[model samples]
Target: MIQVRGIHKSFGEQHVLRGIDVDFHEGQCNLIIGLSGSGKTVLLKSVLGLHSVDQGTISFDGRVLGDMGKKEVKVLRQEMGMVFQGSALFNSLTIAENVRLPLDFFGDMTEAEKDERVRFCLERVRIDPESFSKTPAELSGGMQKRVAIARAIVLNPKYLFCDEPNSGLDPETAIVIDQLIHEITHEFGMTTVINTHDMNSVLEIGDHVILMEKGVKAWEGTMEEVMDSDDSAVVEYVFRSNLFKKLRAALKKA
Candidate 1:
């Protein structure tokens, strides 16, 4: 599990996250959702350690991240994996090579061991084995996302982080991607954190949901609770549309 307590972050004169507290459980897809400037992205970065927090603490299991020494921080980073909004694959490298990059840089595995690991990860994400040698440019957007996920898990990380995992895919493809990530989180029992504005993803895979507004945590709960919530920020941001209202009604009827 990952725990955040009294998190406060600032950028020069602006305070972006204020007294945010939440817990992300393992074997679950935890979602951070909010409007564009609601501090969701900044909160995700703070949890990822890409941006340092100005106050409070973040802990993975029982280890406090803020107190980690240089060597300890490096070790903690090895246990974490990230999938970016853009898929961040190397255009020059083959798909297999891209997945193997982490192992090449961080693993003690021999060549054969790395090859086997890469192959397993790719297959796990449903990428065709025949496409191993293809560059990122050759595949569709969804396929690139699958490759990114394969690479993120190649190192067998204990925690996985995804930012806008369904950014540019068609709705059908986006659902596939969301399900893939959810399955991996449960199958590997990894603590997964996802930052997204995709409401479909929220309803489909949000095991734990945190709603943010204006640098504060406005609400936190499971999807079922989210639907029943009366919080203004959550209602306005997540269910303001008639389409979403109809979807909610459909879900409730089911």
Candidate 2:
């Protein structure tokens, strides 16, 4: 589990995060949702130790991030996996090579061991062996995203971070990716934190949801609680979707 307590961050005159406190549980998809410039991204980065918080504590399990030394921080980072919004794969590298990159950088494994691990990760993401040699440009957006996921998990990380993992994909494909992330989180018992504005993903796999607004945590709850929430920020954000609005109305009638 990851815990944040009274975390505050500012960029010169622009304050991005204000006294944010939340817990991302292990073996669950903990989602951060907010509008543009709402501090969700900053909060995610802060948790990942990419940005320093001026006043607060972030703890992974029982270890506080601020108290860790350089070597300790490096070890902590090695245990994390990140999937970017754009499925940031190197176009010049083949799928297998991309998945093997992390292993090359961090693993002490022999060549054969690395090859076996790469193959296992790609297969886990449902990528065929025949396509392993293809570059990112040769695959569709969905396939590229799968390759990114395969790379993220190549090290068998303890924490998985995804920034809009479903971005740019069609709704069906997005749902598939969402389910895939959800399954992997539970399957590996990893602490998964996702920064996304996709409402469908919120309703589908938000085991724990934190709603941010104007640099503060406005609300937090589970998926079912979100459906029933009357908090102004939660209601406003969720009902913005016609589908959710209609679903809420149907539930009211039922």
TM-scores, in order shown?
A: 0.96, 0.97
Residue 54 accuracy (lDDT) in model 1: 97
Clash pairs of candidate 2?
A: none
Compose the digit string of candidate 1's lDDT tens values, residues 37-96.
999989999999999999999999989999999998898888898999999999999999
TM-score of model number 1: 0.96
RMSD per candidate (Å) reads 1.3, 1.0
TM-score of 2: 0.97
Model 2 alpha-carbon miss at residue 157, Å: 0.7
lDDT of model number 2: 0.94
Model 1: worst 10 consecutive residues (lDDT sum): 226-235
Predicted model with the maximum TM-score: 2
| Backbone clash count for every predicted candidate, in the order shown | 0, 0
Task: List, residue by residue over 1-254, the lDDT tens digit for candidate 2.
Answer: 99999999999999999899899999999999999999998999999999999999999989999999999999999899999889999988999999999999999899999999999989988999999999999999998998899999989999999999998999999999999999999999999999999999998999999999999999999999999999999999889878899999898889
